[model samples]
Target chain A: MADATDSSDPVDALLATVDDGDVAFDGLRLEPVADGDDGRFALETPTLDRSTFGRSELRDVLETVEEYVTNWYYWQGDVGGEGTARRAFLRWCERAPVVGEAVTAPSAETTLEANRTARETANGTAPETTAEADQSLQVPQRQDALRDGIDREWGQLCITARFVDVDEPDGVRVYDLWHVDDADSDVADLEVYDDPRTAREIATTDEDGRYRPLKTAPTLPSGWAFTGLSGDELVETVGSVYPATIANWHRERLGELDVDHWLETAERQTGIYDVVDELPRDAVEWMADACCVDSQCLRRREWEYEEGDELDVDGGDGPFPCREPCSLVVAAARKWAILESETERTYELELTTSEFNQLGELIDAVAEGRTDEIREADLGDGANRYRARYLRAKRFDDDGLEARKRPEEY
Target chain B: MQALVVAAHGSHLNPDASDPTYAHADAIRETGAFDEVREAFWKEEPHFREVIRTLESEEVFVVPLFISEGYFTEQVIPRELRLEGWDPEQWDSDGTSATEVTLSVGDANKTVHYCGPVGTHDAMTDVIVGRAERVTEDPDVGEGFGLAVVGHGTERNENSAKAIEYHTDRIRERDRFDEVQALFMDEEPEVDDVTDFFESEDVVVVPLFVADGYHTQEDIPEDMGLTDDFRLGWDVPAAVDGHRIWYAGAVGTEDLMADVVLERAADAGAELGDAIEIVRAGAGGSVTEPADVDGTAGTTKTGD
Candidate 1:
């Protein structure tokens, strides 16, 4: 429960302002007794029973508010907490039109009056601020702002926390965490989970049932949510879906992220991976460009060649920072080192200019993971499925490409 | 006193690589020996760099569930844990030495007693023997079958082969098997030559590696002619090259590995007082036997 002992805060201010008449805003209604029987008042919501409390029992009212709003995605810790990924996400939820227009938008009259007042004030003239703007904008009820719910998109997940009419207060607040694809689907239409571990299982595969080696790859499947999770449970589910994302994001905000650069990480390799250190510095850049791109991974790489020697390529633009090169990178570097050790050899092959361009287009399409988007019917597209098949049929023989043998075979 | 951490090299592709580690931790947790038992991974959640900070315990015992003492145990875990006295230059220094290391975490000091890996423990010899006997489904199967211990050997680190060789020698000295020969995956006398190396008509190959991942599940089985197609599991006692062979899964995945981890941690805990005493004596401080040293034996221990 939120402590409401302080009289100067917004909760007490709202409580003090409610006179003998009732004040109604959002889904809550507060009324004061005309008889003033022990200074008691009734606080009522559609989902919960009307409860009468004395003026001194403000903490009980605050507790009810806390329980009600927190269930509706009003994460108290992140609301006024450090500017972490969670805080950034909340800001996006309130400002960006995730599902539709922003819910906190003021009335049309209020907006028009504010725009006119802003134009006059900026012109350095006597302020023509409407009398209604001062009362509605400046002196708006703080309680109405506190009761606001959230609806936002995080990765592929559509999160909705809002008040819903139900028989009990526990059921008043409903939180729905589902796939963004299923935003229009009813709750009964989607598969629901309650345990955090279920998120880990869901993350193991993609839509085509292929194993997702990279958890943060932009291929998370749809149609499921760990619905009705508490704030702690929701965080745990997110952690299981994308491990260490919150921790790394928080560490970066605190400026305490320990980044192990490519050279430092490669030098620490032992066993068969010790050969990774022997990779030429130029080859390191190529590996990062190939593997650390946003198309392949979803982490913002913080590591570089070393301190003050950033890579020429762009790191990913993910919301969370990758403090070090993951094990997948290290393992891949080992194989790359072996491949890089081979001597350069040249073999002659005949191909037309268009054929060479088509080959490049094919490679680019595969590398950027856009092959699936190139439909087989799109024959005009060089990297289309059927077009690639035709290229393979023309260039490939049983022996090798273009009937050309390798230098070693010759 | 508060927690036991079993650290292992997990794989990003194979979720089952950490299954055995989690199962062992759960088994130990059910025993109620410690307040918490956690499994940290090199390639999974609760990563080595962050698992320590998540611990509420002041005293922690970290036991590596690796097959042998090598790169990961010696360099990676210590550096990731940020041990107070870890020196990067000392490549030959054994990080598995039963010693108390202080982790300086923001002014307060936390004690982490690093224990030797469970794979190199003497009790692991029993795990190998158990794997052999279970695969054969006979208590006295060692009398007729030659046991082959396979390891992921590398020229980069001679210690990887040494651990397998030590276990092979230990098993041979007991005279429980008809024949025991150490085989390597990357060195000579490879696991592929298992059927031809021994005179016995029947052989039982037990992989002395951690996790039943790629190596134990596919590579070794495929190379030994136990399975023609690439798959995860192999039904053993299949005839190959005129020899009937029983291929067991990786020894680290065996249920007895939980006991091995507990043994490693308990041994380090039992030696903690002696380690302190030796440091005290080296500093010319008078050492006296503590009066409250309990003789109760098992996994749980009290730290003063």
Candidate 2:
């Protein structure tokens, strides 16, 4: 960990220590947001507002880190580019206590000890000491166990290289190892390495890197190669060997990416946002009456529509804190419209102007509850069908009027 | 005698909420027990109100296929069907009362027998126990596992919890499992606190809901930390927390429920003349109607 008392500029002070042979260090700081008046932590940044990110975003980042760290060797081999940066940051978070405590990295000895203890407990046998257990454990078994242990603990910390845009023969690329608990603080400082090979050599070298050293370096599996690869490329290349690791890495990335552009388009097309834009007063009032999808928006009554006012369809981008085109509203409207369109419906008869006028009269008669008077009118062909249509139209008109008249009824 | 309508609280968002009701209705219809066996839902078509208009039968028996005797069974069914003898004002002021009423509908004084919900029937305790027992790896060594009867309890009404407690007590009396407890989704002794209730490593949680809807399919499994990868109506045990959690489908969807519905219908004084034929054909010897056996009238098979 870099000494805090070095200088005022934490980034430059830390960066100054990086040499050609030493581990590479990136100046990026990941820290926890501080508490605010609203009893929530607000991210203090220039590019993003205090309200732009929340605990959810922090959780996503942590989840990403957790995945990469838990399966480090796989990520080291298979994933490349930005993935390497994320893995590196996570490793740094693990090694650097200022960032976060690393997840428990189980060792071969510990795993063997645990298995023996479990066996003893289940069999009701007397517990054996470490020395006794070690004496009975075979050499090949121990080696296999140790290999499994390190493999399990792979990516237990952020282990990746960072390339800084500097005028250097090796391109100023540095390997980093650090860990930061997402909940504790947002600020994370990395431990840097000069090159990928140097970083791996140090990592495997007992008492030097984040991991505990094995008695002997485990033999590499068939087809394993680390030559000619950058620190990031090495991690990705290693990660690619394990199918699950790469698959999970891809799965996590897919979740992070917003692929629901159709959902947004659907919301924009049919949402109350467009309705509000068209008839600001009536639509907003209708929404208020219809009840805004957000249960927390208590200012629904006070929401008055101005001509130039725009409802925040995204719930955060607008000037006003109106949750007008909420997810529920969009979903409900889309579903209702879809159901209406999908249902088998037809208008069989194309009436003449005279027939249309008569139909209107019939609808009015039904709306006015003049059924007794309409019963005495002259009967025409398809009279029953016309009457049914008239009743349906009247009911539709009544429903529309009712919706407008008393929005509270909904 | 004319028509049998299974009334349920359906969901507009989840169509599967009303699926079991429709399925049960179809099964019962195949028996030809009544003129028509139809499903009436509050959310879907044919709607509860619109259902009556379509029913050509003068006499109707509406058996609420809900798990407990709560708001939906007592209030919603009565209100929607416009059944006589239930005061709308009294229902609105006090909600559903404990007293079950048999109402008459239409000017012809057509009898509309409002039977007790299928869940509240005395035979249902056995159904719940059976659900839990099916998932038990060793049925003979019942002491190794715990049985949890989960219900959709409501804070608004104590009756919801009471029904669950009633079934739990009966299951406990049988003394088949090491422990039998009642848990709720919306009340104390919640589904989340299930581990605290059971010391046994293996626990079987049987949801006493009416359908394999959102609550059963998503919420309960999520709360219990069980993977809900299976489709709706899949009755299988999921492993969680080093224990096997046998999540049974809602009690209302069980094949044996056809018997319970007929029992409810019989209790309401409906002449179930061809019920034996329906049970024999539809349930395949699963349902034993009271009227089928001599001196077995009003006597249901109970858990020991």
**Fnat, one value per model:** 0.34, 0.00
Model 2 chain B TM at: 0.80
Which regions of candidate 2 fall more than 4 Å away from where they truly are? Answer: A1-410, B87-100, B106-109, B136-143, B228-236, B274-304
Tell me the deviation in Å of residue A264 in model 2: 37
The docking category that best describes candidate 1 is: acceptable
The C-alpha lDDT values of all candidates are 0.64, 0.46
Writing each residue's lDDT as its tens digit, candidate 1 over A154-180 gives 556666654444323232334557777
Residue A141 in candidate 1, Cα distance off native in Å: 10
DockQ for every model, please: 0.24, 0.01
DockQ of 2: 0.01
Instruction: Tell me the tens digit of each residue's lDDT in model 2 across A1-410.
Output: 11321433322332232211121111111333444533222222112333423444644542422221212212222232222223432232122110111111145643343334223322343332222111222222322332322111232222333323222211223333332121122222223333333433332223322221111112112111222344444443333221113222322222221122222323334213233233323334444344442332221211234325434432221111221233333334444444444434333344557656766766655544355544434455223445556645654454332123233333
Point out the worst 10-residue segment of candidate 2 chain B by lDDT.
Answer: B295-304
The Cα error of candidate 1 at residue A377, in Å, is 4.6
Pairs that collide, model 1: none
